[model samples]
Target: MLDQDTPHAAMPGLEIPESVAAALSGWVQQVAEQTAGPVRAALEQLESEAAELRDTGAELEAARDQALAASSEHQAEIERLTVELRDARKLATEALVSKAKDQLAIDGKDRQLADLRTQLERNVAAQGSESDARLAAEMELVGATTARDNFEAEVRTLRGQLDKSYAERSALRAELETLRGKK
Candidate 1:
């Protein structure tokens, strides 16, 4: 009898003649060949799936990069717009301040003209049609009146300019507000 611990006795309870052993060995080889076909098919399918996953990962990475670039571009545009808006606001404020100063100057001129007219009236009342001095005083009054009229005309022109500047400033503010609302 063969030693039970030998490699040939590893299949327990299998007593085979030499011819039977040869036939069984051929059957095992056929089974192994059949199993190998399915195993190779399964390995090929797994490799195809892995390749698809890699391609998909690459596509996803490309999409992520595109999204990041677009976001950066958008942020840059926003920064540019913000700078332009600040500049516009600064210009509008300067214009308003300039207009206010012009209006104040016109008011001062108007006050000066009023004081001159009052002084002339007092002089006329004090020297009631006396002589050549009175005539000279009347002439002076006429010249002062002309000067006052010129000053008033200048004031009117300044007021018109102020009004135009204010209108322009208002329009700019409205546009700024609209831009801010879009954000």
Candidate 2:
């Protein structure tokens, strides 16, 4: 047993021989020296991996934010196009109604001119008035046909635009879904 004066005898009843303690200390020192380099290298590799993970996280966050912004813009554009398409459809309906009215007027005028032509077959003065009526009806019909064609073309263009808007919105939704899936 070691006496109180021994350096390793601080704990009572646990005294060790000087030579045995010295050998144990030496062994511990040797083991520490042997493992220090590998332990430090492992710690350094772990720190590097953690740093890389943090950088990747930041980049992923930025990309997600950008995708969200783009999705917002696409939704707004789709809504605006929807409103414009609705308005164009209303205008096209009015144009169709106007065209139908013009057609009815033209049919009535055609019938009246036919009657006049038949009666004027024997009167030269009446024949002149009949030609004038026919020319006026032709001009009116031409104007109405041109207006109807223009409105039909506009409707077709609006439909095409609406289809494009739907497609763009669908693409955006798919992108958003992909982003969410990644998360």
Candidate 3:
């Protein structure tokens, strides 16, 4: 019986059967498999070649895994940057809209201020004309009052001259009557 750790053909000083050795030799010659005069030599060469091929396959698998990891990392970074860019654009648009609304409100307030100023100026102008008319009416009233006072003074002086003329005429008539009584 062959142990799991030791092959039967690898034991030193062990003799193989004549029929098994003849059959192995004939198969090696038929297949043209090269060996170091022992059937184990060909098997060792085949195992070395298989090990080298497994090492190459392992190296290729590791490279493929690394490439996939790098690609995934790049994709994650791109997605994060895309989300950040979208947020920035949305904030900028909102800021612009708010600024536009504020500007329009300011423009409306400015127009209202201009209209108020114009209305105040028109009211002042109308008041200026009313004040001028009031002053002219007062000046005419003063002129008429002065003329009436001068007319009253002239009428009083004329009545005093008429009374003095009547007294002079009565004295002259009495002197003539006395002269006639003396004759």
Candidate 4:
């Protein structure tokens, strides 16, 4: 038991005895241990949860980095494919232009062939007209030659008849003169 009139019980100039101070310190330590046990367990559980959360965050960050890398690779591939597609379009356009030019050349050739065919047909027709004209002229020449040869033969026959008549006349005259002299 403590004396109530002790200086330690007074508000000022208080001094505690060594035995009671030690007993009070021991009781305070026991009460602190008893009250802090559940708090410590809870703090440990929170710290462990925080460590797990940090690990999960690191994993998420790594996953995000991998996703970003994959996205960058996909973007580069898309760009490359776009360039290839543009080149392909350019090639296709060039091919189309070349084909159009070739078609134009072929059309020109076809026109030239058509013109040549027309000229050949005209030449053949002109030659046929010339051949017909030449054949007609040759027939006229042959008719004229046949008429000249018939006229020459008729003149020769008339000359031969005239000679025969003259010979007969001369023989008669001689006979008449001889007869008269004899008589």
> TM-scores of the models, in the given order?
0.49, 0.73, 0.39, 0.50
lDDT of 3 by residue, 15-103 (tens): 88999999999998967655544678778899999999788767656655665555565556556655655555565556556556645
Q: Is candidate 1 or candidate 3 better by lDDT?
A: 1
Using TM-score as the measure, which candidate wins? 2
Against the true structure, candidate 4 has what lDDT? 0.62
Off by over 4 Å in 3: 1-47, 116-183
In model 2, which runs have C-alpha deviations exceeding 4 angstroms? 1-17, 32-40, 180-183
Q: Tens digits of per-residue lDDT for model 4 on 1-183?
A: 878787675467669999999999999999999989999999999999999978876766665566556556555655665565555556556655655665566566556556656675867755555455445555655655565555555545544544554454455445444434443
Candidate ranking (lDDT, best to worst): 2, 4, 1, 3
Highest lDDT scorer: 2
List the pairs of residues colliding in candidate 1: none
**Residue 183 miss distance in model 2 (angstroms):** 4.6
- Model 3 TM-score on a 0 to 1 scale: 0.39
| Model 1 spans with C-alpha error above 4 angstroms | 1-14, 106-183
Task: Report the Cα lDDT for candidate 3.
Answer: 0.57
Q: How close is candidate 1 to the true structure, as a TM-score?
A: 0.49
Superposed Cα deviation of residue 7, candidate 3 (Å): 62
The TM-score between candidate 2 and the true structure equals 0.73
lDDT of 1 by residue, 1-183 (tens): 878687673556767899999999999999999999999999999999999978876766665566556556555655665565555555555555654564565456556556656665778763343344445545655655565555556555555555554555455456545544543
